[model samples]
Target: MALPFLPAEHIPSMFDELDEHGDNDRLDAVMAYVFSIWINRSVFSMECWSIFMKGVRTKNECE
Candidate 1:
């Protein structure tokens, strides 16, 4: 699959934002951040979001 269109410079900022959340609500914070991206970018649909989240869950499970 093609990588998402985020620019290189935006990555650190995103991580910095994520870092603000406490560990207890980290997953919720991440989902909110992802939803923000979907809303701002307007290229990804809810279907894509759902699939991406499922992948995240699977990855976490494997670890």
Candidate 2:
């Protein structure tokens, strides 16, 4: 499916930005300071948060 606001060309830039910081493990911390490429960032906020949450989720169940 196509992204709601971002163009295909900008996707690479996103990955590049993420990669610049380090590995996927640091994505959550990096995401907190990210804001670009997408024209309507607010619309993508949930998606970003979703990615961050998924990466940080632990095997232990929530108590």
Query: CA RMSD for every model?
Result: 12.3, 12.7
State in Å the error of residue 16, model 2. 0.6
- In model 1, residue pairs whose N, Cα or C atoms come closer than 3 Å (at least 3 residues apart or on different chains), thus clashing, are none
Candidate 2 residue-wise lDDT, 1-63, digit = tens: 133234444554665565577757567555544535342365655345333223335776562
Q: After superposition, how far is residue 12 of candidate 1 from its true place, in Å?
A: 0.3
Cα lDDT for residue 5, candidate 1: 34
lDDT of each: 0.49, 0.47
- TM-score of each predicted structure versus truth: 0.28, 0.26
**Top TM-score prediction, candidate number:** 1
Among these predicted structures, which one has the highest lDDT? Answer: 1
